[model samples]
Target: MKRKKFASLMPREALKRSKSAPTIVVIGPSTSGKSTLVYVLVNHRIIGFITVGIGDKSQTTIIPCNFAFDERIEKDEHFAMRIRIKDFSAKDVHIEILEQLAKLFASNELSTEDTLDSIDVEWFQNILEPKDAAYHLGKMEKQISIEDFKESIADVLCAIENAEPSFSERVKVKKKELAQQKVKISEIRRMVFEDIWGSISDDLLARYFKWLDYIGENITNNLNLLLGEDNSLGGIHDYSANEDDIFMYGGTILQTLFDPFEPFSLIVEDITLACRPRTEIITRSDENIPLRFCLRDTMGLTQIGMDSNSIKDALDIALNCSPDSILLLMNLEERDDVIAESCDAIAEKLSKATKLDVPVNVIFTKADRLIGNLVNKSNKETVVLKQDDYDATILGAIDNMEENIRGYLTKLPQKNGMWLSLRYLDEGIDPIQRALKNQGSDKFERFTPTGLYQNIDEIIRETQKRILPEGIETPLFVTAIDADAPAVEMKVEGKMISNIFNSIQNVLTEDNSVVNGYTITTKYTLSGRSVVAYYNKLQRGQGHTTRANVYGNFSINMKAMLNKILCNEIPDFLTLYESQVIGTVVDNLIDIELEHLVQEFDKNQHYKDLAFCDINPALISKWSDKQRNTQILHQAIRQYFSSSEKYYMVMDKVAFNLSYGNEQIRKIIDGVYQKPISYDQTMREMQDTFKKIFATQAFSAIIAKEIGDAMTDLINKMIILV
Candidate 1:
């Protein structure tokens, strides 16, 4: 009897205002059963939750709809808790407009009781004018005139008139379709002209006409600008001329009550929810406690802007509420990337919207669908399920689904995640209740003003670090030193050109790392070749040739043959000397130069190619002397051996000394050769003869000049081998 009496007072208690109740904003995707959840939470019944039917197509909750209930907690003391649930509208603008309306209504001086009369002009400018509906229409006003909007409507009406020839034909079709929520043109016209327009006063009607005129007169001068700019219309600026005129252009008012473009735009015919907070009372632990909260619904993040003008308004309303705790409701009955993306998009938007680090709690609804799967997992597939086992099924399924949701929500920036089935609301709502309780806990301070500012700063700093700037690098210079050896040292006149190398030493000796604002690197190569094998390659390339030339005095007629031998053998000998001496010196100089160039390259990644100074001129002068010597040898051999006197003497010896009748020649040919002459002594004599030939100044100059030219050519090629 006590329970019965308390139940009877539910209606009366629900009507009273509960000022101390905490506000909870319900945010989730479209048709996530947010409104239904509120109905059960407040009244433990689903009936009369809203004026319109509840389902996929009949979701009429377009504004901030408020519901309240009471809960009693038996803590150390019996504390009664009043909870307020604010359910939002399907359209985003409605939430934006209603948030302001609800706040003003709550704080109004004349609001002795919660009533629609409290919603007024301050609500229009601060809230409704900034919303997408009014803002977008105002922007597009220049693009759309009253005539254009009316003409589009006329075209639709004309098409409908042709399709439905008679009034009875239209009525029959409308009745059949309307029963299923399939609206027809005639039904929409009736809803707009008869029901909507008939209720407005003459003054409001005049204002509506004037707004239409304003749109027609101002066709968009820059449609592209209108589309891009967020604040293009300068909202409600001109409406200040007549305060009542602003109301006619209110986002909710113009689009909801007196929609003038019903036939042209599908959105114009849609219902607009006037979401207001409703308070209710409940008795727990024998205490009557009022629970005050606000439920804020938004157009699905994925759906709102794509098909309607609700995206901007939805975000604005969310920002305005400054929700202490947000509930991200996801449906568990289906799984897809779209659903996941919507959840992610909403979570990100909420994080950016509030200054507080408000916690986002993910609630996966419709867990009942997983019952069969859970039952199968329990190995009871063949067994008939009973009512007693329902709890087990729900528990098992919720545990599994929670793990799956956690897999996803963990990746998102949210706090906790849970699953619920409205069918088991008696037990299912426990998770939601626990989440709601967290909002009042000590940890909630992390989302306060000071905490938010610190978090924002950290985020900005981290973002800055990710971008690299051009101003942070130090320039580097490099050089090399062959300090001890003069042969390989780079000499500009008597002084070595080692300033670059000196810079490196100065920095190192001074215990500093850089010189003249540049980091200096130095590489030192030995002044001379370390191994003979290193000079062997230089010999093969530019100095030595395989064939040898024979140079001697010859008769005039044999001069051509001697000249061929002299050219081939004499130059070949000079080439060998060129390879051993001049070639080695030039190669050493190039190696040193390249070493410095390479050191510079290693220190700086920006230089991809190498360019260095030409081979040292002093080294070239030394090589030129070698070339002159080789040329002298060639000149002496050619001039002495190819002349008339030397040629005649060579011919006379070949012709007369080797005559057929000569007895000494015959004896040598008859294998009567005396005991072989000392082999080592003959080789020694031949070497002495060649030494004496080249030892002449004329011979040395010719060979030196020629050999030097060849060595210089080799050095020039090696330096550019970058």
Candidate 2:
């Protein structure tokens, strides 16, 4: 045969000169007709591809095939060149990995960082040597010697002809003998271990063995049945393919490659998928555009006994590609509920894999089935196929399909979708063209790793702003006796106590709720020395710390009166006053909470990694310190009224003992009545005099001083302790 050079990896210089193509990995479940669509698209360059099943039963692809071509963009004058198209079809092994990946995706265990240490381009390239016509033709004949092969063929023919033992029975007997004569699995394992490929880990070897066992038990039996029967091979005696052999100047192997119309089983039942890049020169009436691209037909994530390593490889490559878009194909034959569930699961997986920013185009395949249903039902309603009559129904169906798709994908980070079918090509609408039209995308946008770091830095800045109020250098207020006598500021600074600062800093730093979505965090700190200095400056002016006097040398009667007015009763009264103060503070800052600061902060970090460990620790430390200090200051002011509670308690007890005697009041009333008979007027005068004496400056000063001192001591102690 006049053979042409087979496709190979593009040269480095050629790659550098050519425009880079955007890859869109085609992913779906097995038997979803992924390859069939690819086949149609590559063969017909006019409109696009179809997904109608080809061959009797679907033949699995054995190799990851690449179909690279130039898709002409004729709409805009600016886009006259052909867009590179790479379509990849997965093998059974790759499909299995995808299935496992789907399970992990559903459980939310899958991550984009997963690695396939042993699976790479080199691994795939080394599987088989590229051969030409002569080598392939030589494989057409049986492997055994001529004599043995002829004898075996004659015996098989005789057995079939006699029907003494039916063809199936004879085949089974041959299979049984072959199985009995086969090398032991243990011996094969030893041989494999001794081979140059011994670098394959024992764990991987075990998995491979398990996979082989599965194929032997489930797939091999069924595939053998198909091959031995009147199916893909077109019956045992039907050797009509010989005509192509003569025409191609080779044999069956060479003929399949040269013939365009022949059905070839390219699907591998084993082996994982890998990318294969090709170059093509697409010539138009106006110009010729040379394009370079790679197509990777990812495995179906909806199968059994999947390989984790392969799944990891697929995920790693897809994510690293910075793919301009993703084409997610789902089979529409499933019920709406199933489709919705699958969409939701896949959307979550894709969101995590793509970091929730890449645009995804959801495609619903098997539209032909829906069209058939519409036609069959419509036939009952109308005599002929009329576009006008079915327009509303078709539109409604399409709308519903899109709605269902959107409903599930809405939960995903990104939303983009379309539906298609290749069954009714005679119809007016062309889905392939629609799909191709949607290919040209806007700029590829993503919140990159660097962007994530920048976002964290921004958050730290904003958090710093919110933590400490502007122009408030000293968050603490302390009363001083004079210029010396340990100025309040000096005392606070020398003591190294930051009760207010530390408390606030702790809240901002340690609390996860403060910054839920920010993975990169920072700690905030307040300058203790600066705060003390600020407080001391304030003490020198009218803006001084609160001061009060604690009463001393009190008589028993005075104590009783104080207890009655200042301890129990006064404490309750003060609580009511404190509540009012707190209420006012909350009301004034209502706008802060209403603004949804946390929500805004979270939104800022939405594209970033979700967990705490992903953030930079050094940044987090700085942010935390500052936040804690601010929170502590806020709490100090918020609960300032607590200082008065102690004084009120002491006074209330004294007041309880100092009962206002009715006898004394009666005597005064009696004297007034006896003298001028003006009892009511005289009684009012006496009451006013008593109130003045009890509400003197001395009493107020003492209580205020006691409360202030108690509070100051408590604050200082807390700051130092932390």
Best by lDDT: 1
RMSD per prediction, one decimal? Answer: 42.0, 35.6
Clashes of 2: 64
Cα error of candidate 1 at position 75, Å: 26
Which parts of model 2 are misplaced by more than 4 Å?
1-19, 31-33, 43-56, 70-141, 144-292, 299-324, 356-358, 378-392, 427-722
Tens digits of per-residue lDDT for model 1, 534-618: 1121111111112111111111111122223333433333333323332223223344454453343233522222111254556
Name the 10 consecutive residues with the lowest summed lDDT in model 1.
Answer: 548-557
lDDT of each: 0.32, 0.31
Could you give me the TM-score of model 2 versus the true structure?
Answer: 0.30
Report the error of model 1 at residue 709, Å.
96
